[model samples]
Target: MIAHSVEDPLYYLHNFRQVLQWVEQRYADLLDDQELAFLQAFVALEQSAQALMVRMVMRKGELFRSDRLDYAEIGDTVRALQPLQALGWVREPEQLSLDQLFALLRKDELAHGFAGQLSRPRAAKSDLFAQLQGLALAPRPLAQWFEQAPVGILQWCLQPLCDRMRLLFFGNLYQDWSDFVLADLGVLRFEQVPFSPGSRALQQRSEVDLAMALHHCTERLEQGEAPAAILDALAQWRSDNPWLARRHGRLLFALGRHCERLGDWDLALTVYGRSNHAQARIRQVRVLERCERWAQAHELAVQLAAAPANALEVQALQRMLPRLARKLGGPAQPRRRTTAPQLIELELPRELAELGVEEAVRQHLAQAGAEVHYVENTLLNSLFGLLCWDAIFAPVPGAFFHPFQAAPQDLHDADFQLRRAALFDACLGRLDDGTHRQAILDCFATKHGLQSPFVFWSMLDQALLEQALACLPPAHLKQCFLRLLQDIRNNRAGMPDLIQFWPEQGSYRMIEVKGPGDRLQDNQLRWLEFCAEHHLPVAVCHVRWGGPA
Candidate 1:
C-alpha cells in the first residue's frame, strides 16, 4: 500500500535506479536479478498511474477492485488507461484496442497473445429454491449475485473458453458473457452467491439485512405459502431480530393486515391481535369492522382514534364511526381532527428563487468568497446515467432476452435498461466530447415528451451540461450510482435541489433545501449519508418561509 501511494512520475524515475542498485547487487549469483528488479518497479509504477488517475476522477477516493489484471470484462481499463496518456506517464504505443492493452501489460502470461481465451465454468445455482421447476414458478431468490460472486484467478486459467467459437462466427465474441457475470448480468440474474454457507463475499457487505428478511417473507407470500406458516416464521425471526419494538410491530402489523385483506382472518387475528403491539391492535379494529362485529369495532376505534399513531387508522376510525352512529340511530358525533378545516391557497411553483438551494449555497460559499456556481438538479444525474450506461443497460446473451414486440416478460433483458442507459450515455458523451452533440440532440429533440426515470434529458443540452458534469468529483458520481443501484426508487428521487459547481477547480457540493417547518425525509437522509461518505459537500439549507408578498 505504501509503495502504491508513490505516484509522482519524478519519484518513479529516482526510485527505479535505487531499486536496481539495492536488489541487483545483493543477488549477485542470480543472472536475471536486474530483470526481476525492473519488473517489480514497473508493477509499482503502473499501479501509481492507476492510483493517480483515480485521484483525478474522485474527490476523496473510490475503490475500483479487480480479481487480477486480466479482469477487463469488469471494464474501464482502457478508459482508465487513456487518462494516464493525458497525464504523460504513458506514451501511447502505436495502437491496440482496450482489451489488447491488458494482454500487453501482463506479458508474463506467455500465449498466442490476445487470441487466447478465458476458461471459466458457470457455477450451479445453490439457493434453497433452485430445485423448483418452470420459469414462472421458479423462485427468484434474494441474493445479490453481482456483489457476492468472485471472479477468481483460476477462472481465466482453467477450463475451456466459454463459447470461444462465437468469436469466429460473430466478430465480437461478447466475451463478457463467458467471464464475470456481475459485469454482464444484474444481481437479479442469479441466486445469492455466498463465500460459504454461513458467510458472504466482501462486496456483498452493503446489502441490508432488514431487506433480506422482508424479501424472504414477501417471497413466501407470493409463492402461495400458508399464512399460518409465514406467521410462525415471522414470530421466530422477530424473537432473534434486532429491530426496535416499534419497527418490528409495524412489520408484523403490515403483514398481518395484508393477510387479513386476503381473508386469512384467523392468522391476521393471531398476528395483529397482540395487545402489547399498539399498531397491531389498531389494525385489528379494521379486521373487526370487516367481520361485521360493529359494536366491538366501534368501541376499539373510539378508544384508539383519540390518540392513533398511524394516519390510516385515524381515517378508518373516523370514517367508520359516523356510519356506525347513523346505523345504530345514536347521537354520538364522529370525531374530527379539527372543528373547522384550515385552508391555504393551493397555487404552487411560485418560483421564489430560481434554484433555491443552488442560489443559497452559491451565496453562502460566496460570502466566504469561494468561487462556485450553484446549479440545479438535472445535469448531475444525467452525467451519472452516462457513466453507467453500458453496464446497467447492455443485454447479456443467455442472461435475458425480450420477446418480439410484445410486453417484456424478462425485464432483466439488456434492451430495457439499455434504453435509458444509451440515451443518457450518448447525451452525456455528446455534451462532454462535442463529437455527436447534434445527432444526440436531434434524437432527443424529436421526442419532447420523452423523459427518463434517471435523467431529465429534455432540459439538458451539450455545453453547460458537460461543464456541470466535469465540475462534479468522480467519487460523487460513483457513490451516487452505488446508492441508486441499492434501492432504485428511494435513491433516485432525493438528490439535493442545488449543486455548487466550481468550474475552475472542477468540484461541486450538493445542497438540500427545507423550509422552516419541513424536515428531511428518509430518502433525503440516505442521499446525505452518501454525500458525507464521499466527502462531497452537502448541507441542509433552512429557508425562512416569508409571508406572501
Candidate 2:
C-alpha cells in the first residue's frame, strides 16, 4: 500500500519505477533486454514531459480563473501514453501478465528514440508524436512487439468503418455501433489473418476481443441508447449464446423494460414475472403498476407490506404503497414533513441554531421531571404524530391521544400501546408527510420483542399489515418479513435510515407525517406524485380539531 502521509510526486514515481522493474526483470523474460531498456527510456521521457506539463498547468491555473485548461492538459498528457495499449504489448495471450506487459511497454517507450524526440528541438517533422498531436493521440499497441493491436483500438476503428459500410449499403444503420462493436469484440472464434488491415478481414473476431465489445453494449444501454435497440441486442445474445439461467433472467429484466416502453406490456410483464427472485417479483409489480394494472399491483404491494418489517424489504414495500394507493385513486393530498417542512425551514437546522426541533423536544422532555420516558426514536415519535394528526384532522375528530403523546401512568402504558396500535390501524391507507413515513421506517429499523406472528404487526399499523397480508403471495411475504426481523435484530445501533432507504429498493414511495403547524415540502409533494403514478396509496391525514381539508 502506498504511504498515506506521502504527498510528493517522486514517491509515486519511485513506486511506478519499482513496479515496472520488478514486473519486467524479476517476474519474466517477456521483453528482450534491449526492448525493455528502450521501454524504460520512453517512460522516463514521458514522465519528464508530464512534470513540465503539470507545472505549466499549475501556472496557467494561477493566471486564469478557469481550471478547465489545467484539467484538459493533464488528461490529454496521461491519455497520450495509451496505458491499455501498452499492457497489450508484452502480454502473452497464453501466459499474459498485465503488469509484465506494461513494464515492457514502459521500457521500450523510455528508450533512445523517445528521449531523442523530447531532447531534440521541436521541428516540423511527420513523426509519430506530431501525428499523434495533430488530430489524435498515439495508437496504443496490443503488445510490446505483438503484430495485432489492442482489441479496443481495433473496435474503435472498426466501428466507423462498419458504419460507413452500413451507410453505403443500408438506408441508415439499423442499430448503433454498440451491438456490432460488442459482437466484433466478443467474437468467440475467428480465422487468423496474415497482416490484413481491411474491414472484411476484421469481420471474424475472437470472444476475448468481444469482451470489450459487450462492455461497450452495456455502456451504450446505460448511456440511454434506444431501449428497443438495447433489448433487441440483449435478446439476440440470450437466444444465440449459452448463458446461465440466472444471468439470462437478469438480462431479460433489462430487456423487458425496453419492451415496456415499446408498448409491449405483455412482454414486460412476462419477463419481470418469470424470474423467481424477490427482486423480480417487485419489478414485476412495478411493470404491472406502470400498465395501471391496479389489482395486481395492489396484491403485490400488500404482500410486501405484510411480509415483515425488515428495514430493506419494508422499505421496498413502503415505496410501493403510495403508488398502489394512487392507482386506487387515493385523493391528491399535500406533502408534509415534520422535519424540514419548508424551504425556509430546510435551512433552519444548519443556520438557525435555536430552531433545532429535536433538541427542543429533548429539552422539553428533560424538564418534565417524569421518571418514565419514551424512546427518543424518531420513528416512534412520527408514528405518534401520524396518530395525532389522524385524530385531530379526521372529518369527525376523536379526543384520545396516543399514550406516547405524553407521560403515561405505569398502569396505562399497556393500554396506551393497544390504543396507539389501533390509531395506526384507523389511518391504515392514509398518507402523511415525512414524519409518519419516517416512523414506519424506524419501527422496521429496530427489532420487535418477538419474531414470528407479531413481527410485521409490531412494525406497522394494523390496516397496512392486513393490506400487505391480503396482497402478497404467502411465501414471499414470509421471506420479506423474516428478513426485516433479522436486520433489526442484527444491527441494533447503526446509521438510521437516511438518504438511502435500502439497496435496490431505493426507488419507492417515501411519506412524511407532520402536525397542524406543519406543511408539506415540494420534494415531498413530488414524491407523492411519484407514488401516485406508481399506483401506491397515499393518505395525508391532518389531525386538526377542524374538519378534513
Candidate 3:
C-alpha cells in the first residue's frame, strides 16, 4: 500500500515508482543483491497504474474504489514484509501479486516523480497541469480525491491552481472559457474573489474583457434589472479601484445610460456629478433636459460654460433652453428698475473713488466666477450697469440663466430717463405724433437697434402690444406711454407710411406683420407693448413668401 493523498491515480502510481527507485538506491549497499531484487520486484507492483492485482482483482482495479480497502488494512499488508511491499511503502495483501510487482518496477522512475523533483526548490512549481493531464487519461475512477477534502478547502486549492494554469498556458486565447466555467459552477464567490488579475491585467493591453463586461451589463439592464442597483454595485467597486481613466469614463457613462432608461433623472444627475469629464457632464445634463428639469439642466449648462466652454455643452444648452422656456411659460419677465437719489456728478467717497466702478465690476466678475450667469443683466450688454445698480436682488434656486433674482422696484430718476430714451427710439417711424419730433426719435432708434428700450413708445400704441409691456413695472412706463400717445395724436410727432391713427382710441399705431416664431427685440418690444396698451387693433399676419396669403 502506498501511503499518500491520491489526487490523481496515475500520477500517484508514478510517484510511487520514483519513491521505490529511491528506496532501492538508498539500500543498495546495505542490502544483498537478493534484497535489492526483492525491492525491485515490489516496485513492479506499481504496474503502469493499469496492470496490477488492484486492477485485476477489484473488477476494474481502481484505487480507493470502495471503503473496504481501508488505510489501516492496506498498511497492515505493506508492513507484513510481503515481497511486493517494503521500506516506507505500504501494501495490501488481498489485491497484490507477483506479476503486478514485476510490471510496475520495470517502468522508468522519472515519469512518476517529475512534479516532485522539478518543484523541489519551489513549491509553487508543483505541476498541477501535469497532474490534471494524468488524471484525465486514467481509465479508472478516482472519486475519492474529490471527496477527501472539504468543499471549501478543495476550492481553495483548486481555484488559484486552475487560474494559474489557465493564465499561464491559455493566456488571452481562452480567457472567457475559464471565467464562464467558473461562473456557471456557482464557484465564484463574487464578493471574496480577488479581483482576478488575469483579465484585469490583460485589460491594459486589450480591453476585450472589459468591453464584454460593459456589453453584458447593458444586456442585463435591457432585460430589466433595476439600473440603480447595478450602478450602485459598480460604484462601490469603482470607488477605490484604480482603473484606466478612459475605461472608467466609459463605465460611468454606461451607468448614466441605465439611469436614463429608467427615467430616474435624479439618480442620473448624481452619477454624472461624480464623473470628472465634461462629456459625461453633458450627457447628464441631457437626461435632466429630457426630464424637463430645465432649471437644473440650464444650471449645469451655465456652470460648464462658465468654467470652460465645452462646445458640446454649449450647443446642448442652447437647444434645450428654448424648449424649456416654452414649457416653463417662456422666459422670465425683466424686473422693474429701482431708483436712487439724483446725482449730477460723482460726489465720490474716498473709498469709492479709490475703487472705481469699472474696477469694482471687474473684481466682482472675477470673484464670482460661476460657470453660468444667472442674472438677465449679465445676458445683455447695455442693461448690465443699469440692472446692477437698480434691480432689487434676491437669489432663487432653479434660476439657472439669471443667478440674481430681481423683484419689482420703483425706478430711479436716471432709470426713468433711460427708459424714456428707449421708448422714444422704438417709437420713431412707428409713432404718428410725439415730442422731440421725428429727428430726435430717429437718432435714438437708429443708434440703438430693435431691442433697445427707447423703442417702447411706438410699440405701445399698436393694438395689444402695449398691454404686454404695461404688464411689466416701474409705473412710469405707463405714464411715459400715455404722455407719448397724447403727443403723437396732438400733431407733436411725424406719421410714417406704416403709421395710422385709430380714431376710436385716439392713438397712432403701426401695422405689424407678426406671428409665432417672430420675436420682438428690446426696442421693437416697446412699440408692440404701446400698441397693445392703447387698444390699437393691429393685425398680426404671418405670410410665407412663396405661398398664397
Candidate 4:
C-alpha cells in the first residue's frame, strides 16, 4: 500500500516522487535520455517547487493561468515556477492561437480587448467567441492580445515525458496520479501482490512507444478522425507484445465498426481483414453479407462454422450460416435447436411494479422454506474471485506489474488461464476435497473490500455468502467457474437475475426474470443454454402486471 500523510501539505508531492522513484527503479533501462534527465533534475528541486510542478501536472489541460495556481503551501507560485521554467519543463508561450486566447480570457476581458470590434458585448462567452471567429486573427502573446489581462498562461512543456513516466509506473494511461490520492483516502483499496524483480508490463522501450502510439490512434478515432486515415496510420506499426498487439487488434476492430456505421463497407472489410480480434472475422462476414456479396460471405461463414472460435461465434454462425446459405441459393442448413430452461409464468398486482420484475418474483418465491436474492452475476463472480484469489493475484512475471491493479494484467487475454493453470488448478482442486467452502470463506473474510475485477463487495454480504455456499453444490460451482474461465470477458455477465436458495434441502435455482415485452439477449440466452446443458437448475420467469380487473 502507498503510504500517504493526508495532513501533510506536500502529500501529493510525496506520491509524485514515489511514482518517479518506482519508474526509475523498475523501468530504468527503458527510460529515454530525456526521461532520465527529468528524473535526475526533479529530485534536486526544492519541495515547494516540486509540489507546484505536481499540482500543475495533475490538473487538466496544458495551458493554465498563473493566478489560478495559488496554493497555500507553495507560497509565491511565480517563485516556485522559475526553476521549472529554467529547466524548460514549464514555459510561457510567446504566441497563443485564437482558441487559446479565448480559453484563457474572460468574456469581459475579451470585450475589453476588442472594445470596438464586438457588435454584441452583452452576449454569452461562447457567443462572444463566435463573434470573433470571422476575424483573420493571428496568434500573439497575452500582452499583445490584451494589455490589461491580469495573468499569463503557462504551458506544462514536459507533459509527454511525465505521462511516459506515469505510464511506466501504472502500465496504463487511464489511471493517473489521482489514483494515489484515492488509494490514500481509502476511496480505493488494492491487493498487495508480491511483485518480483522481473515483474513489469512493458519489457522494452519500443513497447512503451507502441502503447502510446496505439493510445493516440484510439484518441484520434474517438475524436472523429477519418477511419481510413487512422487505419493507414495504424498500418505502419506492429507489436510483438501480446498486450500491445491486443490493443492494436481492438483498435482495428473499433475502426471497422466505425466504417460500418458510416456505410463504408469496403473500408470496414479492409479494416476487419487487418484485425485479428476474436470477433473481426464474423464482423467481416456480416459486412460482406450487408453489401450483398453472398458468395464471399458464405465462404467465410462456412469456414468459421466448421471450427468456431467460442460458443458466441458458434451461436452467431448458427443463425448466420443458414441465412447465408439461403442467400447463396444453397440447401438450407439445419438450425441447431437448444433446449430452453424451465419457464415460470406469473401475473402480479400492478402495485408490485415499483419493486421491479426481478424483485417482485423474488417476493413471490420467498416462503417459509425458500429465500430468494438478486444475485445476478455478482454471486458466481465473487465466489470465483474468492476461491481463485491466490491464482488471480499470482506473482507471474507479466501478470502483475503494479500494486494498484484490480486483477492480473492478462485477466482478459486468451492465455489468462493457461498462464496460471497450476495455481488455478490448486484453487479448483480444493472443491473435490470439500475444502473450497472454507477456503472461499477465509478469503472472503481476509481480502474483503480490496479491488478485484470479479468481487462486488457492495453487492455481497455474509448471509448471502453463507446461503450460496450451503445451497450451491461444489460440482455445480466447478462447472460455472470453468465456463467463466473459458471466456472471462463475455461469460462474466448475463447470469440469471435472482437465485432462490433452499438451505435446508441444500438446493438452489437461478431465475432469469423477464417483464412484459422483455426478451433474453444473446449473452443471456448463452448463459441459460450453458446452465441447461450442465443440468444446473435454472428457469426463465415471464412476468405480467395484472390489475384489479
Each prediction's whole-model lDDT (CA) = 0.44, 0.37, 0.36, 0.87
Worst 10 residues of 2 by lDDT: 396-405
lDDT tens digits, residue span 71-95, model 1: 2222455454554455443342333
Name the candidate that leads on lDDT: 4
Q: Which order, best to worst by lDDT? A: 4, 1, 2, 3
* Per-residue C-alpha lDDT of model 2 across residues 1-549, encoded as one tens digit per residue: 121112444333343343344333322233345445544654655664433322432231112111222343245633533442264321113332333233333333423324433433243333433433444333333444244432211111113322333222111234331222222222222212122112111122232123234445556766777755655565544322211233345455665666667777777777676543335566667777878899888887787667643334544566677767776888743433322221111212232234344333323333544211222223222333332333222211111111111111111111222334455444433332324344444444442322221222333554443332233233332232222223322222221111112223222112233334766554444334433444443334232222232
Q: Which of the two candidates, 2 or 3, achieves a greater lDDT against the reference?
A: 2
- Alpha carbon lDDT at 523, candidate 4: 94
Name the runs in model 2 displaced over 4 angstroms: 3-6, 10-215, 235-264, 274-278, 294-353, 368-549
TM-score of each: 0.31, 0.32, 0.25, 0.91
Models sorted by TM-score, best on top: 4, 2, 1, 3
Residue pairs in collision within model 1: 366-369, 395-414
Question: Candidate 3's residue-wise lDDT over 1-549, tens digit each?
Answer: 122334344333343344335333432343345445545555454443212223222222222222233333235422333432333222332332223222232122222323343333222323433443444432321232223321111001112222222232222222422222222222211111122223232323133334335445555666777767767655643322223333445556667777887788888887777655436777876887788787877677667657643323444455565665566677753433322211112122234324543332223333543111111111111222112211111111111111011211112111222334544344332333332233332433343322222233222222233322222222323333443333222211211113233334434333333222554343333434444554443332232222222
Which one wins by lDDT: 2 or 4? 4
lDDT of 3 at 14: 44
